[model samples]
Target chain A: MVFLSFVNCMRVKGPDKFWKRRQILKLAAHFYGRKRNCYSIAIRSVQKALQHAAYGRKVKKLERINLWKERITAACEELNIPYPLLMENLARCDIALSKKTLADLAIWEPRTFKCLTQIAAAKNQSYPPTVKAALQPPPEGVITRGML
Target chain B: MNRPISTYKRVQQWAVFGRLWFLFDAKWQNPFDSAEKIAKYLAGKHKPIYHPLSDVGDHVVVINTKDIALPNKEWRYRMYYHHTGFAGGSSWTSAWELHNKDQTKVLWKAVYKACGGSLLRHNMMERLHLFPDDKIPQELMENISDHMKQLRPVPKALHEYTEEEIKNFPKVFEWPEDYVLN
Candidate 1:
């Protein structure tokens, strides 16, 4: 019995493992019923919450980028310039503005955004492929030169 | 016949091509459970592009609405209710009574309730179709490339063994000379 007790003690789980589980349970303390009190369910909740949290972080970034793109596109449409053309000319003119900043400018600083659009429009006119594509005759009874 | 599973590979094909149709059998199915299941397809709940407003859901054709099995004695106890604005206009009928009259009504009502009860519910309901029997229209059947798994497995019917098979069956030991096989 004495030897068995010693062996059991030697093979016992380390304090680190115990503390890690306890930490996860602490994080899951707000959970209800067995999910908070029981080790198995609490650990599962913590792991699932962690997985979703990681996914939410990526989703947050993507959603913000989409919002910015939508804003910029709408502003470009009001100025009669295509989004791709405006972005290309902005890069050409060394106007290194992030989408978030551009979106803010589009909303709050419309005059400045309009000036930028004018520059892009001028660049679009002088540009070869864009101008040619814009001026192309309807090839196969298509209604419009621009993509509908 | 073998049906292809709509895994990531198959869904990717839809991105290049288009959506596919699914068939659901409501034989021995519960109202609430089947409603929730069908609602997922009707509301586009299973798709990644699903939104409450976007019309991304696929067509779902349900067969055997007549054989739908309710949990417990709900066919007797459960009520289908209706009322008009006029006095003494309220009426009630049992689920079985309603099903006997219009077998598809019970399932339709269940599905209507399961849908998110928003303004978009009507749009979602439009994609759902119910048939009382297995005799589906040919055009609808032609597009059904896959089948949804049953909620609970249908139990196999039991039958007695045939006399010829029993006689030919292997036995552990020969019967005693005096003993007679029953």
Candidate 2:
């Protein structure tokens, strides 16, 4: 019974160390409470489950930021506003939000974020202006545009 | 009272009502310009008995905050953040919203809110003085701003080290070749 001996050897490695044991115990814990009398068997089978939970924390920060960027980018795309154009428009309007903060707010505060989307939508419907018109102050001799 | 953790500067938290009640007020000083001045007064550093590392100060109260200035452009540009604690629940309002809503509450709210209403904070807040008006009696503030502006004489040099010799010093430790035998 080489397999039985191998299983015994794995049990000595503990529930947090053996790969097969780890997976089985995690699956068991996910689907069934580990309180069953036979759960010790599951624990033996999934020896490294706890280890996986503890040691599997190496997600790259840049990759996470990129993922967030993609989410915001997709959301902006749906509003028909390219990211650069939207950013430029916001800057022109003097919005001082950072990209990371906006991305986080986009994820965490969706309804509030929709207000920004509404602003973008309004911009899309507005009349086209002379390129860089937003960059300049009103002419000295002429009244400011949008003067009522 | 529990002893302070640091060797220098003792601080004790005090129990008090949340609203800043004035003993009296002097002329309302522009707080933003006088933030340093007011902090020194409240912190008790304006006294001749002041020690650099000691916490020997009286509390300060401020009122009539409606006149404080923020950089004018910031009113339109800056955003204050808040959360509703649900997915997609983040929100921000403009500085204009903050100013319009309760400008007087801004600094006081920010200070106490940051301190977060713990027992320790309640005690420390006893030292704060905020007045909402410029009419606080002159005796209450007592030349604090002017006194804070008075400069102390420059201290004599301590002469710890010369800068020129510091550059020639070796930066790293060298291991001995016979470490195992030693």
Candidate 3:
């Protein structure tokens, strides 16, 4: 690690460039053609891929939320309750369940979801005529203003 | 994990992912509305474990599709379009015309449209079994363990009502003796 002049000393990069290019090349190993082996090309593709990987992490979360909402909505529809009504009523009832949990219950524990819908439906006074007709009597041990 | 606990977990996983056959009686139901619900089940959106890439959709046995009711004059005005991918190859078929040609086509088309243009649309459609009437095959009937509630109740026509029901109907006011019946 000796430089002949101040100019050469300034030109030297810290540590080694091999490891730097190796890091980028590792990520670009699966890339095609020159992108996999060429340092300049691999660095560009690696940076772009890393950016996409970062963005996809956030997108994955939102997509899961959307899917949970869809599943919950489907379950609500099957029970003759609108998604909003069920969510509002559940919140009002102090039943703080996340969309993920509700969706899980809807599929794996449908009977439990049905009971939740019944509680929600019972709490609300106004309902669509068709849903009203289809509504079952509220479960025992729970009373709402509508019942009173 | 212990062997017994691992076996129990495996069984739980199977139970959670198992597909069920749904029975939807489409008699007197609006096909468009019914299709929306049917599409949900067909796509397995009703399940917590549903993933767009996973093949977890349930089978739907839709009976009495021939008797589906269309709102307004949709049967006359709603047209299904087809194209042969050539010049002057496009054709339009009315809902009624399509239904007449095949009793299940109208509802099938409605469900197809309801499923949207996802890559999984055809896969979901394969799970739907549309019967023109209630005469479902024994194998399919045996698979159905749950029924989808109809969106609307079937209305009873005057002739369909019993004599006792008509006689017991409350009248707002009796027709005046002098009033002549139309």
Candidate 4:
């Protein structure tokens, strides 16, 4: 009697069964035809969609960062400067502005952006200018440069 | 004995070159000079820290390319060449024929050739946009900070007449009833 009572089986369906199906079907209403009405298909799609939704929220943050980087680069160009140079100079001068802040200045405040560019331009680089000379137009083919 | 000289020097060399967004109005401007400016910005040559290997450049939005000025009779003489690697499939089209088909192509080609296939040129080309008219995409519009001074003033339309002006104009020359201008 104890062993028989201990054994649980899904043979007998209860209110929980219909409740689970109803929840899935309701969520799947936006889906086409059978996925909404058919419990089996609805279960599969809703499962996948929930997984995608969870992953998408994480990716949205990275996408916004990339957009800010592009905006900042474009803004720097408006003042006739390069993005990397501005970043380096700002860091050298101990200005801890973020990409979002720089991008905002590029779009909303042109004069301020220009001022920042001038400050960066004034801070001269100590490296041999030849580092830039390496940036010549390459002949359109395989390059065999042994030196880094 | 000197205070961290090597670290400071290295930091200065690697510092970021701030990018700028420029607007180029191709309307009625000499195509050659416009192309030169486009290439310079595309290659990031306008900066002191510009390196061919590094993508340190500005974005350029070019508008009104339809009205680009071509000097002399280059419209008839200038040619765009293309070829297919086959038995016989080479073709050459005049500037006028090409521009009529797509107004932005002329300036686009000019910037491409000016870059001369440099390291940063292809990525820089991604930053260079060409539009036939002033209608820019909303996303690109946000970054535009300043415009290059126009080379020549946009001329007033010679033959255009407003609807109200046409209605009010006095019919100075009267023709016979049978005479149809058409």
Top-lDDT structure, candidate number = 3
Q: Write one digit per residue (lDDT tens) for candidate 1, span A39-103.
A: 98898888999999999999999987876776687677666677888898778767899988888
TM-scores of the first chain across all predictions?
A: 0.74, 0.38, 0.77, 0.65
Per-prediction fnat values? 0.00, 0.00, 0.56, 0.00
Candidate 3 TM-score, true structure as reference: 0.77
- DockQ (C-alpha based) per candidate is 0.01, 0.01, 0.48, 0.02
Q: What TM-score fits each model?
A: 0.47, 0.29, 0.77, 0.44
* Candidate 2 chain A least-lDDT 10 residues: A139-148
Tens digit of lDDT per residue, candidate 3, span A1-148? Answer: 8566878557666878899889889999999999999999888889899999999999999998998998888777667688998898788778999999998899878999998888877666434335654575554555565542
What is the clash count for each candidate, in the order shown?
0, 34, 0, 24
Point out where model 1 deviates above 4 Å.
A1-148, B1-17, B159-182
Estimate, for each residue in B29-49, the C-alpha lDDT of model 2 and write its tens digit: 333445554444444333323
The window of 10 residues in a row where model 4 chain A has the poorest summed lDDT is A139-148
- Report interface Cα RMSD per prediction: 11.2, 24.5, 2.1, 8.2
**Residue pairs with clashing backbones, model 3:** none
Q: Please, what are the lDDT tens digits per residue for candidate 1 over residues B17-71? A: 3555779999998878999988877765554333455566777899999999999
User: Of the native A-B interface contacts, what share survives in model 4?
Assistant: 0.00
Every model: Cα RMSD to truth: 27.0, 28.8, 5.0, 21.8
What are the lDDT figures for the candidates, one per model? 0.78, 0.51, 0.87, 0.76
What is the lDDT, from 0 to 100, of the residue B39 in candidate 1?
Answer: 85
CA deviation > 4 Å runs, candidate 4: A1-148, B1-16, B153-182
Models sorted by TM-score, best on top: 3, 1, 4, 2
